[model samples]
Target: MRNLRYVLLAGLLGTALSAQADPVSYKLDPGHTMVLFSWSHFGFSHPVADIGITDGTLVFDEKNPSKASVEVTMPLSNLDTHVPALDKHLKEPDFFNADKYPTITFKSTGVKPLGGKKYKVMGDLTVHGVTKPVVLDATLNNVGPHPMTGQQAIGFNATGMIKRSDFGLGAYVPKVSDEIQINITTEGSVPKAGQQ
Candidate 1:
């Protein structure tokens, strides 16, 4: 009876340790992260815009990928179209209305692993006071220690598309192109002990 109890305790302890080993928490490294969007400009060329991320977190579990999730918040005021006049126009009531909305956010609802390091992430994205479902096709770029910082890091590249009209940003419509293509490249690092 004593031997059986010892074996059972050892098995329970091992199971607990294994369960804790897979999921890793990482904080978005803002300086090394980028979110950019491009849209057709009346058949002339594709114009690009930059949206800066305020903060985010990603929880990834390699062993059990279904448990992974990500959440990000972006400041609307940080949007840059590179053209001053156009940038101002985007903030007006006709477009983003930065003063009213203030920020945009995304929170994952589900994750589907597409074989190897690729995943399809379905999430709720809020923009211009409107929330809609969005899907991102993401690829894991790298996951390891950073050479410079020596901290555990993970990198990913993702692409997603959103229709401006769906989010109530329908200004020029067909002329300016309602569909915007988003491209994101980000690096996140594991937080130190006791840190958020």
Candidate 2:
């Protein structure tokens, strides 16, 4: 937890010092953002699902987009596939082991702009108590006025593929596809006071 606080503070500081005019901050909106992902079944079919972020933040560094950062913490136990029995098994030790590891998280270490609105985000992802480096291809959708308050909102699409075994999520190997593709459609909204 101390490490998390430190990284966040550092990110804020970088954003604060670099912006001669103003810094842009984005608070990931749980209602408007989601991480939808899927994995193949027996190497033939794909089973899709999604996880909601309980909290997250992002800073867009126009000059040094490489300095841009994103952080997210999600409740592992909340994972679902819209199927009751399957959901139960997913939470067991063979899968998420929700009882042992209550949370899954990601802390970005680097963000490199590919060109225009495309970027490559690299971070450490923790799942089932194992941490691994993951890279995602991200596309900035748009930035514009918020319909409700006119505050600026930023949207994005990011995708990555992970091998379940790499993260110790290798319970049902061939039964569950080894490679899982994660899709992130993130929309960042200005945070309200007392909301962070």
Candidate 3:
């Protein structure tokens, strides 16, 4: 009877520990993480540009996702619109002015769980030397062991919107569309033991 009581106590303690698991840190996989944006082109079409992520980190706690935080940095030179001419034009003083403001970044301020795997992440986004508050509607796609690397991994897809004028990137305004739709797909992994 004493042994049974001891077993019950142990089980309860284990359950509590599991319920309060510490947050895990993950390094963003640059090859799999990318930011895509699209905007209207003179009411003719919407052109999309792909921006590769340079580096980022994510802190996530599966049991308490609301405590999660993220920080990402991307270089303007990594922007690609498929057309070399257009890409070059975007980096000039007329658009992003990549020479002066070399990088864009986002840092989370708060996280709000919206039930299930959805969340609203509020953060400050810096672009072209301007900073503005933005909110991303994010969804957790999956969290498990990575098949190829055999490391623990997590993925998310998120979307948000911003105005070029807000970031001092408005060159054409209504002509080329001031509003841009931003889409992000990112994969993060826990480094293997003894690896940083």
Candidate 4:
């Protein structure tokens, strides 16, 4: 009976060790992260827009990247589309309604590894109180030590598209291209408390 008890204890310990072996954190270093969007215009010229991630957290266990998670928030009022009149329009109620929403957010639901260095990351994106599923085609750029701080870090590129109308962002419609393509690049590190 003692031998059987030992075996069971060993099995339980092994399970705990296996779970702890998984590395599961990615930090979004805002300095190196950016989000850009571009779309076609009224067949005359192409217009583009871009924003930066003010704050975010990216979590992952590279060995089992399918369990990864991500969260990001951006200031809608900081939108830069290269046109003042259009930017003003975007801030109004018909568009982002910046006065009410203020910020846009995203949180991951599922992560699927496609192959070596590639993945499909899906999440719920909330803008103007509307939550919609957004899929980002992700690529693991590299894993190494950050040159500046010599800290362990990883990089990734995520790109995807969503219809503007889906988020109640329909203002110009056919004239401004409902399809908005996005590209994101991010880097992260572990947190050190007592420091903001």
TM-score of each: 0.94, 0.85, 0.90, 0.86
Error of 2 at 76 (Å): 2.1
Ranking by lDDT: 3, 1, 4, 2
Instruction: Determine which window of 10 residues in candidate 1 has minimal summed lDDT.
Output: 59-68
Model 3, 9-120: lDDT tens digits are: 9999998887676788999988999799999999999999998789899999987888899999999879999999999999999888899999999999999999999999
Candidate 1 lDDT tens digits, 99-172: 89889999999999999999999999999999999999999999999998798999999999999999999888
Assess the local accuracy of residue 91 in candidate 1 as a C-alpha lDDT between 0 and 100. Answer: 85
Q: After superposition, how far is residue 85 of candidate 4 from its true place, in Å?
A: 3.8
How well is each residue in 1-196 modelled by candidate 2, as lDDT tens digits? Answer: 9999999999998987766544478899877777877987777768787777888998886667788899988886557688878888888887888899888899999998899999999999998889999999999898878887887788889999999899888877878778888998989876667766
Candidate 4 colliding pairs, count: 1
Q: How many clashing residue pairs appear in each of the predictions shown?
A: 0, 0, 0, 1
Which residues of candidate 4, in runs, are more than 4 Å off?
1-18, 193-196
Off by over 4 Å in 3: 1-21
Which one wins on TM-score? 1
TM-score of 3: 0.90
Q: List the pairs of residues colliding in candidate 2.
A: none
Please give the distance, in angstroms, between residue 160's alpha carbon in candidate 3 and its true position after superposition.
0.5
Q: How much RMSD separates candidate 3 from the native structure?
A: 2.5
